[model samples]
Every structure is written in structure tokens, then in C-alpha cells.
Target chain A: MNPLLEIRNLSFSYEGSKSLVFEALDLSVREGEFLLVKGPSGSGKSTLLRLICRLNPPLGGTILFQGSDITAIAPARLRRSLCYVAQIPQMIDASVEENLLLPFSFAANSSKSPPSREELRAMLRKFYLEEVEPAQSAMKLSVGQKQRLAIMRALLQDPLLLLLDEPTSALDQESAAMVFSIMERLNIEEGKTLITVTHADYKPVKKRPLNYMLDNRRLNLLP
Target chain B: MNRIIDISLAQLFLALLFILIAQISSFIYHLGLNRDITIGTIRTFAQLFLMGYVLTFILKSSNLWLVLLVFFVMVLSAMFIVKGRVREKQIPYFIPTFLTMLISYFATALFVSGVIVGTAPWWDPRYFLPAGGMVIGNSMSALAIALERLFRDLREQRELVEMKLALGANYREASDELFRKAVSAGMIPSINAMMGVGLVFIPGMMSGQILAGTDPLIAIRYQIVVMLMLVGSTAVTSVVVMLIVRRRCFGSGEEVLLR
Candidate 1:
């Protein structure tokens, strides 16, 4: 089967910088595949995901999402189908429910109805955030809780792929385990494709995930 | 009405006593502001006198093109001042920002002079120049504050903005909160002035008119029009500048590109 996402000869550099972050990089992920890219700090691991999401324009390259050039896609539409969650989860100065419903408020997602209160509460429980009240101020949540809440918020968008950047970096071991377990269920049970970038030693026990190391502007497959 | 009393050069020179008093206070307290005080005093005298001469020439010429040329210069100066104040190195916002300011300032000034004040020729330098200058001057500082707030907030709130973009928000939707805050920052001073006008303090224009021996009631009327014109121009300029600059904050892909 053709890959669900294909990146061909991706290249990027910071403005006015001499060195390239990614030079002639290539990547592909099959449907329902979980990709784990590990690298040291400043290795451009996060930038890889950003490039895929088109948050940072590539110096030269093409990103094909399901065989269509992502550049041809309306940014808002492309983003809706491929949601990205940052390492440091940011919550608006509003209630948790409002934050969760933010994507639906966007015109690109306007066609989809927002999740109902029951559904939102159920999602919170599924994400092990049962204690987080929908009406509670989202900004007041702990970092770990915010991270989980951020994931839950992304899931509400019903994206075709989820790009998570250091999702467990700020969490305690227990919370990290909970996040991993959530990732496991999402991949194995729900068949949601995931591309997570982290420097942590996280591996799912239930299934082996395709792993790569990003170093020196190259992605090398790890045995 | 009695002709307005004119101060001779000697009397004007005596006004330096106020600066002398300030300089002495600076010296006694070791405030280290004597140089700034000196430069400020010099600039005040030189710039005002220069402006007075220019106004006299323009008034005497009474040419519409000349009037517009002065306003153009004022707007251009105001644009550069805003650019200096904003200090954003990454985005090249100069041309768009200048156009926004120029259009809004001219529109506001023309409306005030032509419709509100009812100047005979509408481009009459006597009315148009001051009106245009006031609009540009007030809006210049306001635009600076607004642009500064915008760039700073975009940098500071990069994560939030990116988060919104990642979740399928367009540029406008992603930076909506920051945009509103920036525009508000630009307009708040004008709004506050409105709240305090004719109450806590008489404004500069009103005071000048009163000092020139105009009837207090007529001076109040002009002050009211000037105050309202300022608020309107500030609002329009801030909104327009922010709208244009907000696009600069994002990229063609609708990404937050502040850095």
C-alpha cells in the first residue's frame, strides 16, 4: 500500500542561517503506522513535524498527504486533517470545554458539529483526565494534565493523523505511562496514525513502532 | 476683540528660566538629565520655529498641491517614526504600514476639515495642515504602541498562535486575541483622553486657542471637534495598521512567522 504521508527531499533553514536544518530529507509513513523519531536536543526533531504540518515552510521540497501535494491543500483544511500538539501545551484563558471546542469554531471545521458535553467528558475520562471538569479553567490545570487535555482536544478534531511533539517531556513517569498507554490504544484499537517526536526512551509494549533518529540533518532508521 | 498680545524676543528668551529651574533641579538631585533637557529645549525652539515658518509659507501660497505636499511629508515622517518605534527586524512592514497610515490620516483629516470644520476649499492649508498634522501626530504614537504590542505578543505567544494554527485556524483566527489587544493598546490613550477632556485638564489645542484670546466657548467647540477627530483617526489608523501588519506576522501557508 502507498504511504499515507510522503516527504521527498525536504530542505529547510532558519532565516539568515548558513546551515540547513534538513537537507534532502525523505520520510514516509503508512496508514495506522506509529512513527517515533528520537534525537538529542536541537536536532530539529520538532522542526520535522512542523515542516510536515506546514507550520514552517521548507526551503525546497514536497510534502504529499495521501498522494496530494499538501501545498495545494488549504492550510486550514490540511491542518484540520493533520492536528499537531506541541510539547508545552498552551491553553487559552477559558474553560476546558471552550478549549476543546476551539477547532470546531474554525471555519474549516465548521461543518463538523462540536462534541457534546457527554462526549467531551467521556473523552476526558478516556485520556485519564476524569478529574478535569469541562467548566474548569483550563489554564489552571497542571502541566501534565494540560498535556493530556491538549491531546484530548486534538482528538476531538477527528484528524486523520496526529503529530505529537515531546508529548511526555513535561510529565512525570506515571503521567508519561498514561500518555503512552493512550497512544497505544489510539494506534492499536482506534487505528489512528501518529507521528511523535521525542528524546525520551518511550516504547509501546503492545506493538513495535517504526523508529528513526534525526541527527546531523538526516533521518536514520534505528534497528 | 483685543488683538492678542505678542511676546517680544526678550520675553521669549526669559522663558528659558523654566529650563534653568529644571536644569538646577537635575543638578541638585543628580538626575543626569541635563543633556536631555538641553537638547529637548533646543529642539523645542528650533522645531517649532521651523514648523511655524513652513506653515506661514504654506498659508501664503494657498496652493492645494502645496498643502497636500506638507501633509504627505507629515505622514511620511510619522510612518518612519512608527517604524523606528516598532523595531521589528524580521518582517518588512514599511511600505504597507506607510500606506495604511497615509490613507487613514488623509481620510480622517479631510473629513474633519471639509465636513466638520467646513473649511471653504477643504484643502485650505490653514485648517487642513493642522488637522492633518494632529491626526498624523496622535496616530503616529498610537500606531507605534500598537505595532510594538503586536510584534511582542506574537513572539511571546508563539506557542498559542501555533497551537491555533495547528488546530486549523486561519491567520486571523489564530492571532485574533493578540490583534484585538494590540488595537486596544493603540486606541486606549485616545479613549482615555476622551474620558478626561474638559474635566480633569484642558487639552493643548483648547489651551492654545484660549491663550490666543479666542472666545472660550468657540475654543471649546474646536476642542470638542479636535478630540473627537483624534479618537476617530486613532481608531481607524490602529485598526488598519494592525490589519495589514497582522498579515505580515503570518506566512503564505498561514503559519506564525514572527521569528
Candidate 2:
């Protein structure tokens, strides 16, 4: 079974900061693996996720996606295939419907049709956004609703691999539980690869997820 | 050709007395503009007089090379202003800015010369220098606004762009909104000037033509041509600069080259 993603000797530092966020790091994920990364704030946990998707190019080293150098893949294609959801969801100053359909408008994703209205209503309803209209401004949504929308937007693209940064950090316990359940289904039942970065110890409720602790710019497996 | 009367040095000096109105007003208001006014007056006298002698020699010789050299220098000075004034700290824009000015300034210059004012040699200093100056100067201002807005928007909205990229947008797609805004901002000045031209104000070019004894109708025609030319060049200049700068600011792999 080939690895879905691989990082080789990755070394990186912020533009101004001298200290390396991640140095000489390496890791790999199998096609259906559910991997959870745990670390304190400023541990480069989020940076690691971004690196996987080639958001911030590593100063030194190579990333491989599906046996090809990650740099070789077109950025739009790479992003569409491996969607990333940030910790603080940022919404365009437009309606939720437009935001939801945003990815489908991209050249990479344009070939695919947007999710149908019924599907959208179902997704929104599942996330407790029942009262929110499709044309409601995404900016006016609560933080939790925005997070759900961001996640749903990514799902709309039908990504093969998903990298989520603290997906439920802003949610109430009930919302967080709902999001985690959805993530579990996507990882377990749907067989999609998932890599999640979080400060909390979030164990996968359904499938046994591999836990890794990042320290001193290295990833260590935890049994 | 009608020979025009020239203002004598004494008349010019007497005209200078009009400065007392501003000097007196500044004194009464305590506007602190006396120093600025003095320095500006002196600098205007010195620069224009120097430029007058230089231009007279260049015009007499009709040296195309010298004319082009001066034009090149003008372009350089324009880029220098953009470099210092544009607040973007990201990608090295000196070359892109230089390229933008070069394409825009030359395109407008050639259009005015080859198409509009058909000089015998086509690079006639009399037509090329002044026309190119207006095109280049106005285009420079347009590019300044375009480039400044582009970088500022990108810097301030990095996350928005990144999020777009994350959602699978190419650089052009990701920056569509900012790009449109910058281009529009660049063009708005000339557009607004076009709206207000001839009605609210007599533009300097038209007044200069009229003062030089050209018929008012003929001056108005020239003004209209120049106004249209300015708006056209500004649009072309802003678009070219934005296109080149857009490529420089965003990398081939869809990574933002801001750093």
C-alpha cells in the first residue's frame, strides 16, 4: 500500500523569525489513514499541515503526493485534491450560497457541478444552520456556523485527502461532537484520508486514529 | 504660420509679482506656506529655465537619440517615484515597475506619434517629447495607484487570498476582485477628469494652446484629443502594469510571492 502523502527532511522558518518552525522533519500517511497531530501552541503543528498542501513552501526538502513530487503537481489541483480548513474560518464578504459554491467556480473545480440545493439544505441542517437562509451573508454567521460552512465548503469539492487545522476549536461541545462525528464518517465509512492538527487530545470516535506528538520539530508516534 | 509675440523678460518678471497675493494671504493666515512658496517659486524658475535651454538645444538639433535618451530618463524617474511611493515590501518590483512604465509610455508615445500626430520623421522631438511626456507622466500616476492598491490589498488580505488558494483557485482567479479594484482605482482619476474637462475647468494644455494664439476651437479639438489620449493611455498603462506585477506577485505554483 503506497503512502498518500510523504514529507522528506522538511526545514522551514517564518520570513522574519530566525527560529525554525519545523526542521529536517519526515512523515508519511497511508491512503485511508486517520492521523491526529497533537502539540502545544507554536509547535508548528498548523505549519506542518500547510506544508503538506504546499501552502508555505519548505525552505529545504521535498513533499510527495501520490508518488509524485508535490511541487510537480499544479497548485490548484493539489489544493482541490487535498483541501485544507484553517483554524479560524475566513468567509468571503458574500452570501453563504456563493461561499459554498466558491470552490466550484475555481478552474480546478469548475468541471464539477455544485452540490444541489437539497444536499446543501441537508448539510446546513445537519450543522444546526436550519434558520440560516442560503442567501444570508456568510459574514453574519456565528463562529461555529462559519466553521461548519468552511468544512462543508471543502467537502463540496470532494477532496481525496483533507487537512483540518483545529476544526472544532471554536465550536460548543454539541457542535464539536457533531463535527467530529462527521469527520469520523468521512474517514472511516467513506475511506478518505484525514490529517487533523489540534491542541486538544481528540481521539477518533469510530476508527482507531494514529496519534502523533510534534516536539522540537519532529513527529513521534504514540501507541 | 503666424508669428506669435513672446513675453519679454521684464514682462515675465512683472507677472511674477502676482506671487504677492499668495504671500500676503499666507502672511495673514499664518499658513506657514511662505517658505514652501519661496522654495517652490525658486525651484520652478531654476528647473524650467534649465529645461528651457536644454529643450531649445534638443529641438534645434532634432536629434532623435537625444530625445529618446531624455524619454528613457523620464521613464526611469517615473519608476523611481513608484518604487519609493509604493508601500509594498513584497516582491522586487523595480523591474516589473520599470517594464510596466516602459510598455505603457512607449505604447502611448508611439500611438500619438505614428497615429495621431504623424510627424515627418515620426520621432520628432517637437511632437514626441511633449506628447510622450504627457502620456508617460499621466500613465506613471495611473500605474502608481494600480500598483500601490494591488500590493496593499494583497498585504492586508493575505488570508483571504490564501483561503482562496486553499479552495483551489489559481492566482488569477484568487486575485480577481483585488485586481479589478486596483485597475478601477487607477482609471478613476482620468475618468473623473474626463467628466469634468472643458466644462468645469480649462485644462493647462488647452489654455497653453489658446495663449500661444491658436484658435479656441482648434485648441478645444487638441484638448479633446489629448484628453481622450490620456484616458486611453492610463487604462493601457494600468492594465499592463497590473498584469506584469500580478505575475511577479504570485508564483507559478500558485504560491503568493509576497515575501
**Evaluated with DockQ, which candidate comes out highest?**
1
Mind giving the per-residue lDDT tens digits that candidate 2 earns over A78-156? 9999999999998999999999999988889878988887889888886668888898899999888898889889988
Indicate the residue-level lDDT of B216 in model 2.
Answer: 91
DockQ of each: 0.91, 0.79
TM-score for each prediction?
A: 0.96, 0.93
Q: What is the lDDT of residue A115 in candidate 2?
A: 85
Off by over 4 Å in 2: B1-41
Taking the tens digit of each residue's C-alpha lDDT, what string does model 2 give over B173-205?
A: 999999999999989989999999978899988
DockQ of 1: 0.91
lDDT of each: 0.91, 0.85
Give the 10-residue window scoring lowest on summed lDDT in candidate 2 chain B.
B250-259
- Which 10 residues in a row give candidate 2 chain A its minimum summed lDDT? A198-207
Chain A TM-score vs. truth, each candidate: 0.98, 0.94
